[model samples]
Target chain A: MKKVMLLIILIMMAIVFTACGGENESSSASENEVSIWVHTSDETPEGEAMQSTIDRFNEENEGTYSAKIEFIPRSGAGGGYEDKINAALTTDTLPDVITLDGPNTAAYAEAGMIAPIGDYITNKDDLLPSIIQQGTYDDQLYAVGYSESGVGIFYNKQMLEDAGIDLSTLPTVDQPWDWNQFMELSETLVNTYDTAAIDMAFDDKSEWLMYAFSPFLWSQGGNLVSEDGSTAEGHFNDENSVKAFSFIQEMVKEGYTTITPVEKGFHTGEYPMKFGGSWTIAEMEDYPDVEYGVMPYPTSPDTNELVSPSGSWQYAMASSSEKQEAAGALIDFMTSTESLTEVTLANSVLPAAHSVVEEVQDKVSPQMNVLIQQNQKSAHARPVLPNYPQVSRVFQQAVSDAAYYEENSDVQELLDDKTGQMEKALK
Target chain B: MNTNKRETLAAYSFLAPALILLGTFLVIPALMAIYYAFTDYYLLTPDQRQFVGLQNFIEIFKDPIFIQSLKNIVLFVAFVIPIQVGAALGLALLINKPRKGNIFFKVAYFSPVVLSLVVISVLWLYLLNPSEGLINSLLANIGIEAQPFLSSPKQAMLTIVFVSAWQGAGYQMLIFLAGLQNIPSTVYEAGKIDGVNKWQNFFYITLPLLKPTSVLIMITTLISAFKLIIQPMVMTQGGPMNSTMTPVYYIYQSGFSDRMIGYSSAMTVIFGIIIGIVTLLQSRLTKEDDI
Candidate 1:
């Protein structure tokens, strides 16, 4: 009984604390105060660096609106920040500024929960085109990014060297591998030393597998969202997508890739090359003995454009915000070159602002520049539809079903069925 | 002199707060959800909401993904109940043996019951991770091939059922334990004197007496197991091919992921109706006289 009462009291206190707006800025006569919430787990050094940046912003602002940042830390394995945001929305209280992912930004923006910040970012000439493209929701920008990450081929150089693969004449970004080049290399590299060229975990259950398989779809010009972003077209079962899928299927069949159920292609290091995002750079540095370099995801043989599945995070204002000035100012402070540089070095991602990119590149690991160069012509947000998370999930399941089907299936019919469901979901 | 009027007022006052809370949070939302299910409601974009009467339900029933999710849930309920119930019975039978350390054994087995679902899921995830996990290591030591417990579509559902049974059997075990203690020792002794074997005695006497306890455990567990969201959601995320996607998980996916609160609400209504009917059937079958 005492414990229950104590629990209720604790909950009540949390509600009250969450309700507390940062000490109201005492007008121009007093110190202006703004609250910011960074919705990432606290374990990362990047989050810590971000806190330091917030502290610096506070120190610099003095009596003007001093920006105060708080971390809304989450359990790393589930739900993420959607439930936290939902609770905040219900209470009609929100942080002055929030860092959100691209899909979530679209959902919140479409819901009228977020304010359009195109007016703020468009006027700034330093904004990068690809990053800005990702921040737009319903033809209006609601968020501005400081740093960006995109998928790339991170190869273990020592593994390549041991296999007698020459790096001196490696293809430049323009002359990079198409499907033919990729297959030839994947086959030869695997057979030459009997080492796995790529880790292809056949299981659809792993998050890493989903992340790994996405580039194949993107490389073939397939996408998660419809052209208008209102619906999801079943590109997973498309001809080009199937061709790419069949290639991976053949690799699994031929032993060119690591198809082990327990130990996957990359993390097991059975495969020297890993197709992952810039997020891997920080961890890659720990492998000091393994010489490695990052390159753009191979171009589609058909599209001829170097396409990469990129994802970004945005800082924006909540709809119920009464303190728009404070929110806007906080967002502005976070997006500034100083903060962007800190995030770039800490997170090992490419800076969003063009000017900031040039400055921060030298500060971060040298491998991170691959993201910056890749961002120039080959970047994309995964999908920004309100139904994107579900869409990806449903698509992943369909692809997995097709991949693991013991019997033959009508691929087109499967694709048609998924599209029909997506249409209904959009409706 | 005015005792009747004062009594009426007291009754009204006693009911008022509860009525208000129920009306606001429960009863009202339940009605509103039915209405929303017929509309094209988006939680984030309130303006996009428009009435489309029966369209959402049509869309859902016809949806292949939704159909797969439903099929998965049915399989899950069918698989988990037997596994969990059987395990619970076995545990009850074992622990019913009053030995020197029976109390300690009961406490050890029941410790998982007190743990939070999220904590248990995390612990299980680490313990089941194919490469470095303890279970895999133990299996490797025995020369058995490492299994993809949560990563293979064929294995994921069964693995989850096993984990769920492991976590939940203790609660049902306690009820079975009570039922076991209630059986008079004279019946077993009389059966022994009549030349009945131990197995025969259990089959005839113990089984008949434990029917009520079994029924009680079954009904409660059936209702509670339908709410299995936290485990699969946190662990597998209904993945490896929607093998773990239960109806409640689908409800969350639709309402939050798709932002079609109306469609999700329709799903909720359907869910409520299904549960309501199931409960009624269960009660009808397990009436006192029938026992």
Candidate 2:
């Protein structure tokens, strides 16, 4: 009995010792340490390059400020990171500096989770104007874009040439093809070559399909949610979007975009033109035999304006950070052109800062610059609302189901059910 | 008298740790589950609960999805337990006959019991993947069209059951092996001398002696089958319109994903009661043969 009591006491002592020991060790470095939350490209060569730079910074500025990097793995489209940030906020253990962007930066900044970065943006000329627009949310720079991505048309040049489609006379960046012309080219390529569907993945979570397709929904006179962003608009059932949805479906039905069984689909090269982002360039680099070209997403047949969904992951400061100064320093260092260029090179996207783009222009592939330009011209982001996740989830499930069961499924019914559920979830 | 009193106190003190452990770990949690079954608790946002009355129960009943899962659970238990236990018993009986490499056969039959559930699930997932799997390739050779093993609603639940039975049959085989060892050789020798053939001798001799072992195997197998969560989770994720969704999976989904701790507690309580009732019925049905 005495032994058991003594053992319990020893265990308690050990826990206390460990916790206190942690405090004691950190106290020495806390003055010099910058605890920054790093998201994206932490595993690639370019990510390695950024880490090496930080290592150099820490070694050189050892007495001034030590770099304490905290990496969160959120590689694919940066969808699940918001829930984690929310969880961190509730626990009061947020990092000194965290990364977020697009709807994410907007949502959290509104919630007062991220600190303002206006004081940190003295080097404004060092950043891109469009990227600067994304970083500055609600009149204050809450986050700096780590990398920029724009959804656009990525066509297999070999597939087009084999289909006997003349490519030298193909529409250039300045002379962009309209939706009707794009459709004609796509249908001809598929039919003439007898190839598979358009290269695209149907993800209901990120709804990045919105990037490739939803811009047209807007251009053809539709909105995802109501103007105030208080309600979902049931756009698939709306007259304009219904026609747009049918146009996309006709691509499938008319043999231009066959229903490629999930396996024999785009990523496998069974398809020709992929409506995707800059990352598509990185993915296609492995297929050296397959030559591809990049352009803006097709303009709407009616609107005559090229549209793409613009979003980027950014770095932010957590409200609960104890080492605020160090964290801010890390964020500042990471957002600098040197680090931004490394991130862009790794991710196959545009540099987050203008200076970085100018510095690393030769380093990045030519295919990727088209995406950067596309993002600069036109890309809209999802509405940054607290209830946006729930709204998106409900909308995506309905739309995907609508696409699958085009006839039997009622888009209005699904919209009504999910909207009600969204309202309940918000409450 | 004082010394006697001190000894008595010491005896009670010795029992204190065990009593505290059982009460804290088992009894208290059970009671808390029952309490929370009547409330609506979002685990992520604690300090907020509403007295829901019988609302959770009503929701469970009204939810077609929940009802279907319950029915599926029962069907799985009914079908899997018999086949698995019977196969184990037959295998045990075969190995009981003294032959060359009898121990090797016994060990070979029981090898799968040593494998972890996750390892087994992964192995089966690759083997069961319809497009590029061993099972489908073999089926194609027989001039059969590739069957949607995990993807189709028609085949998913059954595929999970089949995989589970294959993995779990070995554990029950050990129990049956022990039971076979307990049977007397004298009765079998007498049966051989009497003109009773192998089938009659086995049914008449082996069946009665193995009653207790059968009962034990059945009860344990049913409990395990009823708590089916891993196979469906790793393989199907309870999809194709949620045909493979189990009660325990529902409980996890409610507790962690939905953060509806109160609803999950209600489910846990109900599942506990169901298990208790099943155990009671099993004992009652089998207790008569014991005497």
Candidate 3:
């Protein structure tokens, strides 16, 4: 009996070893196939478009080089995709092709987790300058994006009419409203409508704060980090940045804006105007009764430079992938002009390639046209540095503090505190 | 082989699988966490790490946010434990005997315990919104001013504590109920023969008999309360002004979001030691009481 039991144990161990070895053999056999990881599942429109593009690539390539896609859920308790990606980075389980938020390109590249794909991009020159800027780290292109995103002020046409402001006379993108004029318009709208003049989405205490509000700092001739990307002391807490934040505080204190607004305030017609992104145009389609118009982000009164927030998700290559050629082929196909136009239109965002934008300019809605114009003229990408995530967090906290400012609150003091935090993180 | 030796061999064979699983999952990870605490390891580049000794620990001491998180969790534990335990004991006493509505009451009280913490937090967030919320709408109907329950820095932590206590009290109540049922009814009968009132019997008999149960509840609740993260994270995002930032939330942010694995591991080691010491002291004290 003991001999029989020992023989059975040996057989079981052999079976287990065979099963494990089978997995490795199958994976090596399919080495020509590339895998892509995306944030959204295939149920969404953008995800469907991406899958379609991948399917096309697979059909055309056949056995030469096929591609597969995996979707990670974008929302959860522990930071969702960001947390998963970080965990995957440590485990070296990253896919050959990965999509990351625009600002993460620099951090991923700096950590040597992703490889530079500049040479693999076929239409690098045709891509939007802002897209190129967002994907570049240390003068090398580490990622490529199919769609670009831009933000501007979306206003209610009826509210403007009630406030006796002529829509036709409103400043164009070439000559946008300055800070003083913007404030005057806001006051007029609030007084006439007896509601919030603008919804700045202060309740969204996430990356939205940095993405939507950084334009004001840039328009005022300040930045989150120095040009050399070494420090944030002078640039982040400078006089211009302080003034920009003070304007936000003053707007809240003067009742020109609501700090904690109901979500989708503009769509619900609770606010006359809101600082919104290109995605807002798609969302507004659900509220057909609410007629709206789009305008550029306001310029700083002191500088008169037009600045709008711009950046979007980009495709990257993992450094550990042995299938670089197949991965590059998949990326090239997905970011081609036709694919970009299809994905952008399906996703209801701006296209990253200039040629795609021009092709779809007439086909898109008027609001999309305004977004395209802004992207073409004045979109400025956020700071692309390895420490951008930490810097953005400190700036978000400062903005949140300033939004809750009291009578004796000082914007300069808040900025200085944030500057200290950012400097420490940089170290 | 002899019968005693064969029995010992059988016992060792029976325990092997469980021991292997525990060592792999729990013991190995804990040892790794301690080792990682002495290094400067970022999550994004785990292969590249440098020894930093006690630098992370020293830095955490000077880090204002970490200090604030410590204060926040201590305050949470101080507020949550008593309220949760007292509420649980009260419910257990009410339903100790066979009452007409006992089943309904038990189910109603324990419903929130079954719900996920994220769901409860989200439900409470909508209910506690400053404007256009069920709670505020009710307040408006009664001519009371709207309260910024989660938005206000002064009220956010207290609101989280109340919600957490409400959701957790039911589990403790069930434990207390089981303990209460185990007590001899003859003791209560003896108290009644002595002309002892209900309150007197509760204080002298029930309370004294429930000492072990209370110690168990206290230690478990204290340990769980120190790990407060979900409520504040879902509701407030540790905001308004970092008023609701707890140590566990800070650790998660540092380890996962910020990728500062070494700093986060150092915090975990320190927090683990504190929890271990507290648990040890409580067990010792309770054993002495039993003796």
What are the TM-scores, per candidate, against the unseen true structure? Answer: 0.83, 0.74, 0.92
**Worst 10 contiguous positions by lDDT, candidate 2 chain A:** A257-266
Residue pairs clashing, model 2? A34-A326, A98-A316, A99-A315, A100-A314, A128-A354
- For each candidate, the DockQ is 0.34, 0.12, 0.56
Candidate 1: tens digits of C-alpha lDDT, residues A1-427: 9999999999999877766633332343433566677777556767887888778877877766677677777545235576677667766667767878765766777677889876655336777776777777778888887777776777777677777778765555666777667767777778765766765444434434445566667778776556786665555556766665655555555656543333434544657777656656666656566667776666668876677666567789887766777677777777888788777777777777777878876665556777677775666665666666666665665556555434224556656666665565565
**Candidate 1 at residue A87, lDDT?**
66
Clash pairs detected, candidate 3 = none
Taking the tens digit of each residue's C-alpha lDDT, what string does model 2 give over A1-427? 9999999999999999999999998787566676666664568665576677678769777788887665666634553554565566657766677766565665566566777776765566766665666666656777777777677777778777888878776765556777678778877876775764365554222355444566667667676666655555454356665655656655655655532233434455667777667666767766777778876767667776766667677777765566666667777777777777776776566666667767767776767777776665665655555444445544444444444444414545544554565554444
- CAPRI grade, predicted model 1: acceptable
Considering DockQ, where higher is better, how would the candidates rank from best to worst?
3, 1, 2
Q: Who is ahead in DockQ, 1 or 3?
A: 3
lDDT of 3 by residue, B1-291 (tens): 699999999999999999999999999999999999999998888889999999999998899998898888888888999999999999999988797989999999889999999999989978887767898999999999999887778888988999999999999999999999988899989888999987898899999988888888989998999889999888888987888999999998888768788999999998898888878987888788682
Among incorrect, acceptable, medium and high, the docking class of model 3 is: medium
Report the candidate with higher TM-score, 2 versus 3: 3
How far residue B55's Cα lies from its native spot in candidate 1, in Å, is: 3.9
Give the alpha carbon lDDT tens digit for every residue of A1-427 in model 3.
9999999999999999999999899888788999999988799899999999988998999979999999886884225777778878777798999999888888899999999998888999899888889999999999997788888889999979977999998877999988889999998988887777999888888788888889999999989888878999998999999989998888888889876787777998888999887778878889999999999988899999998889888999999999998998889899999889889888888889889978899989888898898887888888888877788889888888888778228888888888999999888
